[model samples]
Target: MRALSVYRDTTGSKLVLDDVPEPDLADGDLLVEALALGVCGTDREIVARGPIWGTERPDRLILGHESLGRVLEAPNGAEISPGDLVVGIVRRPDPVPCGYCAVGQFDLCENGQYTERGILGRDGFGSERFRLEQDYAVRVDPALGLAGVLLEPASVVAKAWEQLDHVVRRTRRRALVLGAGPIGLLAALLGVQRGLEVHVVDQVEHGAKPRQTRDLGAVYHSFMEDLSGTFDAVVECSGVLVGEAIARTAPGGAACLVGIGAPHGAGTVNLGELNLDLVTQNKLVMGTINSNRSHFEAAHQALRQIDRRWLEGLLTDRLPLSAWRSAFDTSPERIKAVIEFDA
Candidate 1:
């Protein structure tokens, strides 16, 4: 099996595609062949900061989590079968399960001891082949084709919108999505599907990001300064704009922070004033990360409702496994980039 891996030591290399042994599967486990793998900001961060959460393995660590695969082997009575398209959920419950983990909400593990595949303690699905327990694998619509790799990231936004649905009680709302990356754009797409007027903010003015935002029947803005009026809901997918996004929320709005990035160095927020605004305005600002199986199921259905051509347009770059080095480079026009294994 050929897999892309990063070394355990601290050298800033992108990734190394190595020929490794195929993993042995358990009797009840399902074998899946990699079809497509989505590479995101977190993958780049792991390469830049080696030996982080993903270095739990002894030697090199597998380097993909957002993946799409086809089942090759399934235990008897497994919900999925051979040739079915699937995506493996990322997180696993801790040894001593938390309250949330006990109920299959490992995404909300109270003790923060959960293991995330490809990102934390477990080996990821970055190779030509991998094994997953059937329970953790969710079937994706076969019609999605190569675009199915996006289900993991889309699941995150789907969970965010589900949370926002519970928080806000108003109708005909307006939503502001910060950062026009995969997560942000998907968040906007979901908001539009929910009948809200969606507005997307990103630094890129004239590229595919802005164009796709408009394609979804949403407004696009390159800068926050030009944004008019307030939004009933705000989703902060650009971690750098958390403070700014929250400040722009309406009096009764809800803000969901979905992106994971460190704060820009050397600045302090006015905690006192910010607290006052949140309390006095009846606002809700929350952070959401991983998703559960149900969220993945929801994302699968949601992705199907979207225009297939538009969904395909989000996939701007596709590289073969041999061109692994170039896959990690960030580009202005790229909404989503993937490495195609079964192409």
Candidate 2:
């Protein structure tokens, strides 16, 4: 199998051409042929960092989290059959308590975890062919289109909405999606579908800014250089230190931080208007990591049912796997860039 890999601990060292062999599998494993894979930010980050898959997570494992592939072989009792189109999720649940596998969240399981599959795991089948646990594989209808192929990330947005849905049942009605990136836009889409008065906030470009909100169906606002009162709820995906800003959620409102950044680099947030000292406040600040399988499933269905043409603009570029470096180094104006595999 020909795949891209990283040797030594450098993001730029991502290997593009290699004839790695197919992996041996256990009775519970399914071998998949990767057709198209999404290179997320971490795909590049891990390449530059010193954490080897096996050494830190998996010894010399492959890097890739959001990917779509075909099932070449399935073990007996596999949930998937050969030749099925499937999306691979990054997190796997341990049948037992693998620390961090808390109820309502199982992606954090640290023990008995597979050596492969997510971006930072022990093992990843980052090749034309790879092995995966049957349950981790999400089946997708081939008819969903290359756009439908976006179910993996779309499901992530679905998962974020699911979390908000649970909270809306009790409190909070409005949502402020804190970035205009793909995740924020998708989260905005789900918020609109679920009947929330959603507002998407981001820094603007000179001309292309208007179209982003026009397609999103959500009211768009620029971040607080034009400051105002607090929003009812917030979903911060701005990719900066948004945690503190999320802490400023309105009373009885909630804030969801969907963006990840460095440890000490967390952003500054003003709390005076959060009304902590001025009034009785009931705010909920939350954070979400990776999406679960249920999220992946729902995202596929939701995206399929939507018009998705606006998403065409969201996918600013499509590059071949060979030119992975160019795409990684140049991703400022882009929201979501895809790597088109063999036709």
Candidate 3:
């Protein structure tokens, strides 16, 4: 099987299109044929900096986390069946299985010992075929087709909204989503689905980001300064503007920070003023990443209810496995890039 992998050693690291052996399934694992894999910043970072978490042989790590596949074989009595579409859950609980992990809330792993597929410690679904434990594979609606590839990222948005619901006590009428990437757009879509007025901000003023935002019946802005009035809910998908996004939330509203921004060497924030605003307004700000099964299931439901055409629009680029290098291009016009495998 041909797999996209990252090879690292004491000398250095590099991306490799290695011809590896077929994965051996565990007792309760399902063998799935890869359909499509979503490319994101994390994959690019790993290609550039190498794997940070894995077994002794980090070089063996596969480099994809967002996955979509079709079951080729399943164990008897498993909830999934052969030919069913599925997405693999990324995080696995620690060996100790902390209090949160013990209850299946491994997304909130307390000990930082969790292993993430194609990420922290395990091989990912970045090949022609991969193995997923029955318990960690979530079925996708066949109706979604290739658009189902969006599920993994949408699950992250689902978890963010889930947390926001717990923090905000009042009715949410308006939402502000910072950044217009896949995560930001999906965040806005969920806000629209919830009947809130959605507004998206991104630096790209004349491209698909703004057009897609408008197509969803949400307003789009080129700069945060152009957005007027505070929102009951704020989703900061641009890691660079956490403080600004939080400041734009209305009294009693909450902000969910989703993006992991790059470090600004000498840049500083006025934490004292930010703290005062939060204290005086009774606001809440929180960060969320990865998702549990419940979030994936919720995201599945959300996708089912969305317009297929609109959902498909987010997938601006789809290339064959042979053209995988092109799929990594970060052009403004490209929203979500996918690599399709030969069936």
Candidate 4:
């Protein structure tokens, strides 16, 4: 089995694709056969901006974290098994958090669980047979196909809902998802799934972007108007500053920041007026770093029912792993991109 990794030398240079050896599974780990893997905004950043390579011990690394696939083996009586379709999370939680494993918040284990078993950096799932923790492998119905396979990516959005209660410790359910990118859309859609009237906002033209939000019952907004402190909670996955800066967070409302985009140089929280007001107000503002096993499981469970036609539309283009250079170099409006493996 072979895999594609993004490499940056010790001197810090642009990323290059490398075909490397497939990873071997450790105890409590499972081997998965890759099917359809989506290129994430994070992956784009690692390639174009190089934030991820900088996180790893070395800059050189594999570059995919969003993926759906089938399981090939499961040790003992683990919940996963061969032939079971699955959606996998890229980040792992640190086990040393006071009680992450005890409380099931392993994803947030403070010591280091979430970023420890990264799928693409040193243990990524971009290869034909990638090994990952069994706990991270949530089962998906095989019937879902490529679209249903998105359970993991969709789960990335599900993690925000877990925090909704945490954000609004005591408040109503009105919610806002800023940015409308895949995660933003998923966040907005998940809010709607839980009966919250969600407002999806972004400055970008709808363009050829997949309109899945409509199906999930979220009303799209262009952010051309003032929000006027309307939402009880806001999850920021748009990766832009203004969304955080201009967000109309109600008093006591909780805000979740989930995007990767940042201002150049000493990136400040360019929250416009909201930044100054948030301090005096009793609002709960937090930065959620990554998703955990429960998030991965919950996300996969909900995504199993997703409409493939709609999900596939999320894909803006399909590039072979070998064509990665052209995929990013061309830099077209790639809404969703997948690197299909050759049989």
Candidate 5:
């Protein structure tokens, strides 16, 4: 089977599509045929900077975390059978098993020993075939088809919303999503689904991002300053606008930061005013990263309820594995790019 592998060391790093042996299935593991793999900033970063928390010789580290696959084989009595569309959960609990990981909340692993597929210490589903632990594979709605590729990213958004729900007791009427990338667009979609008036701000005034935001019946803006009035819920998906997003949240509202920005040196922030606003208004700001199994399941349900056409619009490019290099293009017009294994 052919797989995308990343090799990195003090010398340098490189990405190669090598012919690797098929993965062996362990007890409680499901053999999955890669259907499609989603490409995001994380994948691009790994290819550029090599592995961070990965193996000493990450040459074997397949570079995909967002995956969509079809079951080729399943262990006895597995909840999913052959031909069922599924996505593999990315994070696994550490050997020591932190208190959170012990309860299946590896997304919140406190000991920093958790292994993330394609990111930390494990191989991922970037190959033509991969083995996924049955417990970590969540079945996708057959109706979603190719849109199932969006599930992993959607899971992160689902977890963020879940966290926001726990903090904000009052009704959330309006939301501001600070970025129009896949994550930002999905965040807007969920906000719209929740009946909140959603507004998305991105640098681009035209193109798929703006159109998609409008398609969801949410307002789109080129600049955050153009959005008048504070929102009851704010999601900062653009790492550059954390301060601005929090500053625009209404009294008693909450802001969730999900984007990981480049470390281009710190910017100035007025602690006195920011602290006063938070203390006087009783506002909250939280950061969320990976998601648990429950979030993936919730993401599936969310996708099932969404308009299929709208979901499809989020996928701007689809390329075959042979053209995988093009799939990683960071073009402005590109939304969600996918590597179609079946193509």
Candidate 6:
């Protein structure tokens, strides 16, 4: 099996396409043949900073977490079967089985011992094949085809919106998503599905993002100056807008931070006034990371409801595994890039 491995010594280096042994699957485990894999900002960051969370031996770990595959082998009694399309959940519970992990909410693992496939201690799915426990594999709609690779990222947005639904009380809500990347666009898609008046703000003013936003019947803004009203719920997918998004969150509204930004330098904050708003406006600000199994299922449902043509449009590139280098290359017009294994 050929897999994409990143070198630890050379941070910000390209992935090395090498021949690796095929995954060994247990009887109850699923043997998934990779079909398509989505590459996101986290993938780019790991390639740039070296493997900070996954393996200490940087180059040894595989480098993909968002994936779509077909089951090659499934135990007779298992719910999954051969030929089923699926996406593997990245994180596994820690050994300590913290309260959240004990309840199958490993996404909130407390001990910080969780192993995230491709990103943390475990090897990723940047290969021709990988094996996972049946419980960790979420089935994808066959109709999605290559589009199913978006499911993992979609799960994160689904989980974030699921959490927000609990805190927000407004019937007719308005949402502003801070970035027009995959996460932000998906968040906006979910918002539209929920009947919210959605607005997306990103640096790119006249590209696929703005067109996609309009196609979804949502407004898109490149600068905050063009942004009109405060939103009842703000989902910050780009870390750059945290301050402004937090500032513009409507009174009694909730803001969710989903982007993981780099540390540049320190800046002063008006904690006194921010605290005053927190005290009087009943504002809520929360940060969400990964998603759990249920969220994956929710993501599956969300994908099913969306127009396949729109989901297909988000996949801007589909390079084969041999052309892996081009998969990681950053492009201004690229929306989503995928490494296709078989198709």
In TM-score terms, candidate 6 sits at: 0.95
* Per-model TM-score on C-alpha atoms: 0.96, 0.84, 0.97, 0.81, 0.96, 0.95
* Candidate 2 least-lDDT 10 residues: 50-59
In model 5, the runs with Cα more than 4 Å from the true position are 9-11, 53-58, 264-266
| Model 3 Cα lDDT, one tens digit per residue, 195-300 | 9999999888797888899999999999888989999999999788887788899999999999887897214778899889999999999999999999999999
Residue 210 accuracy (lDDT) in model 4: 28
Report the lDDT tens digits of candidate 6 across residue range 117-172: 88887888988989988889998889988999999999999999988999988764
lDDT of candidates 1 onward, in order: 0.86, 0.66, 0.89, 0.64, 0.89, 0.86
- In candidate 1, which residue ranges exceed 4 Å CA deviation? 10-14, 26-28, 51-56, 265-267
> Which pairs of residues collide in model 1?
none
Candidate 6 residue runs with Cα over 4 Å from true position:
10-14, 26-28, 53-59, 265-268
Candidate 4 segments whose C-alpha is farther than 4 A from its true place: 10-17, 27-29, 49-60, 76-78, 93-98, 101-104, 112-121, 169-173, 226-229, 242-247, 264-276, 279-281, 326-333
Which tens-of-lDDT digit does each residue in 95-140 have in candidate 4?
4545765576665665653453334335566677677676667677
lDDT of 6: 0.86
Give the worst 10-residue stretch by lDDT in candidate 5. 51-60
Ranking by lDDT: 5, 3, 1, 6, 2, 4
lDDT, model 3: 0.89
